[model samples]
Target: MTQTLTGSATVDEVMAALAALEDPKARAINESHGDDHGVNLGKLRAVAKQLKTQQELSRELWKTGDTAARLVALLICRPKAFESAELDAMLREARVPKVHDWFVNYVVRKSPHAEELRRGWFADPDPVVASAGWALTSERVTKNPEGLDLPGLLDTIEAEMKDAPDRLQWAMNNCLAQIGITHHELRARAIGIGERLEVLKDYPTPPNCTSPFAPIWITEIVRRQQEA
Candidate 1:
C-alpha cells in the first residue's frame, strides 16, 4: 500500500520529504505515485504570471544545494517564466543536469522563449547543454510549425553535426526523423541528413532495428523523399 501525501506541503517541504527517503527506487515511486507529485499546472501558471517578480527567487532556488529543490525550481522556471536577463542568469548558474529533460519538455518544446535558450546552449561548452540544445531544435521542428525559426535552427543543427558526440548525433537524427514525419518540407531534408548519417560508415547500429526510432525510419524518410 502507498502512503498518500497531502497536497498542502510547501515546495521546500516536499523536497525535504523526497530527500528523506534513502532508497532510490522508493523515492522515485513516491515522487511519481500520485497526483500530489504530478506537476501542478496551476502552480506553473502562477509562476508564469510572476516571471518578472520571482526571477531572483527562481535563480536562488535553482542554485540550491538540494537536487530536489533544483528540480522543482527548474519546473517552476519554465521558459515562460524567464525574461532575457533571467534566462541568461539561469544559463550561467544552473549546474544540475537532472533538469535537462524537464527543460526540454516544459521550456523548449512549446514556449516562445526557446530561441534564447537554444542560443545559450549552442554557445555553452558543456556537452549536456549542447545535447539539450540539439534535442530542443528537433522538438521545435516537430511540434511547432510557426514557432520554429527553420533556417536558423537547421543551420545550428548542421553546424553542430560536424562535432556532435555520437549520442547527440543519434538524438538529433531521431528528432529529424520525427520532424520529417510531421512536416512535409523537412522530409527531403531528413532524407539528406539520413544518407549523410549512413556515410559516417563508422556509426554503430542502434539496438532494436524495428523500433520507431531505428534506421527503418531513416530508410522510410529516404524512400519518401525519393517519391516526392
Candidate 2:
C-alpha cells in the first residue's frame, strides 16, 4: 500500500486502492469510535503523497461518500483553499467522527475563516458541530489566549459540560484541561469544576496513557511541563 502510484489517479482508481488497503482489525477499532474507515493512515498518506494536492479529485472522491476515499481526499485537498461557506457545508456533512475531526483539524483550522467558523459553530444547536467549534476554541486556548475570557469559558463549562454529548464532552474536557494546564490562577478552579462534573472521569485508559479526565490530564501535563 506504500507503493507510489504513477501518473494522475482517477477517483475510481483511488477508491479501489483504498478498498484494497482495508484491514478488518483497524475497521473494528475505528467502528468503536464511530468511524467506518479500515484503511490505515500510513497507507492513506502514501496514496495522497502520490496523488499530490488534487482539489478537484478530492471533491470527486468526497462525493463518493466512502470513508477511506474521503480521508484520502482530506489528505490531498488544499486546506486553506476552501471558501468559508464550503468549509461550513463540509463540516455539517462530515458527520463521521474521524472525518469531522480531520476536516476541523486538518482543513478548517488552517483556513482563513477559522475564527469566523469557530464563532458561528460554538453555539450551534448541533452538539457535533459545536464540538468542532470547541475544538477550535481549545486550539486558541493553548496558543493564543490574549483576548479570550478565561473565566467566562469556565462558567460555560461549569454549566454545560456534565451532560454534553460524547464528542462535545470530549472537546469541552480538552478545553478545560488546557485552561488548567496553561493558567496558574485558574488551575485549582478548573480541577474543581472537573471534579464536580466528573466528565470522562471513569473512562478506561490504557497503562501509562493520560486519562481524558481533565483534573488528571491537566495535572499530568503540568507535571511534565515542570519536569521539562
Candidate 3:
C-alpha cells in the first residue's frame, strides 16, 4: 500500500520525519517531492498561510541549516498563496541557498508575476541568486521566447558562466536547449553552446550511464537548430 501524508501533520512533524533520514541528500530529494502525491494548489495555499502565523517556527527552521528543513520551507511557501512581493520577502529572509533555489525553481517559475520578481534580482550581489534569475528567465524563454528580455538574459548568462555552480550550469544548458527547440531563430546559438558543452573538461558524466539528460538535451537543441 502507498503511504499518505496527512495535512493535519504540523510542518515541524513532517520535518522531523525528513530529518530522521540518514542520507542528507536523500532527505533533500524526498522533501523536494512534496509537490508530488496529491499536493495541489488549494492544499499548498493553506499550508503557506499557516506558515505565515508561525514566524518563530520558520526562523528556527531557517537557522537549523538543514537542507531538508529548508526544502520544506520552500514547499510551504507556494506561489499561488503569496503575492510576488511576499515571496520575494520570504526568499530574502531565507538563509539557505538550496531553499532559495527550490523557491526559484518551483514557486517563481509558476508566478504570473515572474517578470516583476526577475527585476528584483538585478542588483543582488550574490552570484547564486543572480544565476538563479538567469536560470529562471531561461526557463521562461523556453515557454515563450518572444516574451523574454533576450539581451538581458544573454548578459546574465555571460556574466554567470564565469563561476557558476555545476547544477546552475546544467540548468542553463537545459534552458538554452529548450529555448532553441521552441524558437527557430536561436538555432545557431544553441548549436554553438552545445559544441562547447561537449568539449568542456568537467562536463558531468553520470556513472555507468551512456546517454544522460544533459548531452541528450543539448543534442536535441543542436539538431533542431540545424533543422530550422
Tens-digit lDDT string for candidate 2 (1-228): 634465488887887788788899889988988898897788788898899889999899999988888888898898888899999998998999889989998899999999999999999999999999999999999999889999999999999999899899889999999999999899999999999999999999999999999999999999999999
Query: Scored by CA lDDT, what does every candidate get?
Result: 0.54, 0.90, 0.55
Model 1, 1-228: lDDT tens digits are 022233233445445444443355544553563212333334333333433234344456666655455555655554565665655455444444445456566555556667777767754676656666667666666665575666555555556654676546655656666666666676667556655545243554566543444235756655666799
Model 3 scores worst on lDDT over the 10 consecutive residues at 34-43
Give candidate 1 regions above 4 Å deviation: 1-12, 25-60, 76-79, 92-97, 108-112, 123-125, 145-163, 185-189, 195-214, 218-228
Q: What lDDT score is found at residue 79 in candidate 2?
A: 84
**TM-score ranking from best candidate downward:** 2, 3, 1
Model 1 lDDT, residue 17, Cα = 45
- Of the two candidates 2 and 3, the one with more favorable TM-score, higher being better, is 2
C-alpha lDDT of candidate 1 relative to the true structure: 0.54
* C-alpha lDDT (0 to 100) for residue 163 of candidate 1: 68
